[model samples]
Target: MLNVVALMGRLVADPELRHTPQGLSVTTFTIAVDRSYARPGEQRQADFIDIVCWRGTADFVCKYFQKGSMIAIDGSIQTRTYQDKNGNNRKAFEIVANNVHFAGAKNANGNTGGGYANAQPEYTREAPPAAAPSFAIGNNDDFSVIDDEGEDLPF
Candidate 1:
């Protein structure tokens, strides 16, 4: 069977690292993923999804990601059965993250600040002059041509 999932969204809350009894690190958090479509007169909708990260991935997320930060996750869907305090059985579904990444541009401290929704391109400069270059391509005296005998051909 094949199971894979990829999601990019803003975190609903900061990830808090925890340790299992076996001393393995873990963290659970939710992200708000916007739906692809909406009714013609309605506002866009978003779904809150639960995500689980383990070990190094958990620690990394807790250290670098926070509430409102955009995150990209690659993982598989997982479901579990458990009993809540009321004694009713329930099923929970979440993404078990295999990889997590920063989804926004880095700020001054080399940390991603605003979410991807407001991220700016990494490189920005003034636009080039509208007119074409003054130099003529074939008439340039700086150009040179070489005759190849094929003996030194790389291919």
Candidate 2:
């Protein structure tokens, strides 16, 4: 059995960190994810997805992420049924975040925040190897030209 999800979207609001009765950290927030395609002449749509984080991941989100920030989350889908205040039963689906990360460039202040334990490494370019291997670029004798004009070609 496999259950996994990866999402990138803008935060709808600041994450509010909470704690369980046993002192475990937790946070729940929503993100707006734009649809991949839109109808002709119509505006693109977006879906508001709920996400939940636990322990250190929850604290990282609350401390570094805020309203409108681009966030990346890796997690699994979770569902639960509960009774609403109006006495109606409802089912809720959300992602139980295993990891959360920054998904966009730095702000005007040039601050990308101090990375957490699971944060990905910053993007950097490394110099090429000193002794670059040379390749034969003009060697046409190793290739064969096809004369068929698509009539005998297999699709």
Tens-digit per-residue lDDT, 102-147, candidate 2? 8878667665533332354667899887997766888788689988
**lDDT by candidate, in order shown:** 0.88, 0.88
> Which regions of candidate 1 deviate over 4 angstroms?
106-155
- Candidate 2, run of 10 with poorest lDDT: 111-120
Per-model TM-score on C-alpha atoms: 0.71, 0.72
lDDT (C-alpha) at residue 24 in model 2:
100
Instruction: For candidate 2, give the lDDT of residue 3.
Output: 100
As a whole number from 0 to 100, the lDDT of residue 12 in candidate 2 is 92
Total clashing residue pairs per candidate? 0, 0
